[model samples]
Target: MAVVLLLVSPASQALDKARMDAAVKAHLALFSTDDIVEERFAQRASAVDLDGDGVEEILFMATARCVGANFDCPNELVVLAATAGAPGQAGKRLEPDVLAAAQTGYGLAGSEQIPGEVQAVRVLKGTIEIAFLAQQDSPVCKRSFSTDQGRQATTHCPAPGRHTWTYRWSRGKLTKVSS
Candidate 1:
């Protein structure tokens, strides 16, 4: 009897850096120079499949400063995922959607602040589970009486902190599985 050996390389299963850069660039279009965004190798894209479609998704973090000192602002670490698609662009060149994005921002007021620091991603029992710590704000409501309005309500500030969350892929996006 003869014994045969097979060799497998780990780097072969890794993600392409060029593709990751393209996906990150596409996502950066959503923010302007005034915003604070972190787009780099936060984690390995090959670690987990974000969309459960056999293809991998890239995850990154971003931040935006919308409020001033008086506003009830919370520091957020935005967790973003990019999927494979031809999402649609208005540029002179062709840009493919290589990630999944949701509820980031559009340079407007009263937008949702979802920032998560990606800790780890694990594929358990064929289910992709992502672990992260995101921002969560709880408003401190205050009530006051006024002559003109009789009663008024005001939200002074929101206590935001990094909360642990477990998210999964659903419908081409990362949905909160548990927090």
Candidate 2:
């Protein structure tokens, strides 16, 4: 009898280096090398200009075995922002409210559960339109707010299982605008 075992390769599932490098250099120059790690190989980076700033940010997703002590696991989405000028310039980390919304619904201070995902971010005439998937598996949780108004919104889905929340800059402070 003959038996064969198939092994999947992690490198084959890694984010794209060209794209990751570009994004890291563009917006995340502040992060130290210890804070960032290129997982899989180079096949997990999707580039897009979220703010329409002409710079391509990277959306990296990958699954790998845990190799470090800092994190509990390796199944996580590594979101990156790419800014114009300079390489290795670290982008800003998402605020707690935004992170909370992305993970759950009902904003940061609420106790409601909504499944969702952040689809896209667009800036037009000083206002930022955060397009995302919201509760009940709807594809139209289109929320808009002024980046200068200090209000932010959070998004959650009900069926598809995706979440994303955004915090806006207003009056020199970041605030939550969505519930």
TM-score of each: 0.43, 0.27
Which 10 successive residues of model 1 have the least lDDT summed?
103-112
| lDDT, model 1, position 156 | 32
**True lDDT of residue 149, candidate 1:** 50
C-alpha-based local distance difference test score of model 1: 0.40
lDDT of 2 by residue, 1-179 (tens): 99999765642323356545543333332222333333332223454443444443344433332233232223223445322243222585765434432332111111111123445544433233344455442323323223576645433223444444444433322333453
lDDT of 2 at 94: 68
Off by over 4 Å in 2: 1-43, 67-71, 83-179
CA lDDT, every prediction?
Answer: 0.40, 0.36
Model 2 scores a C-alpha lDDT of 0.36
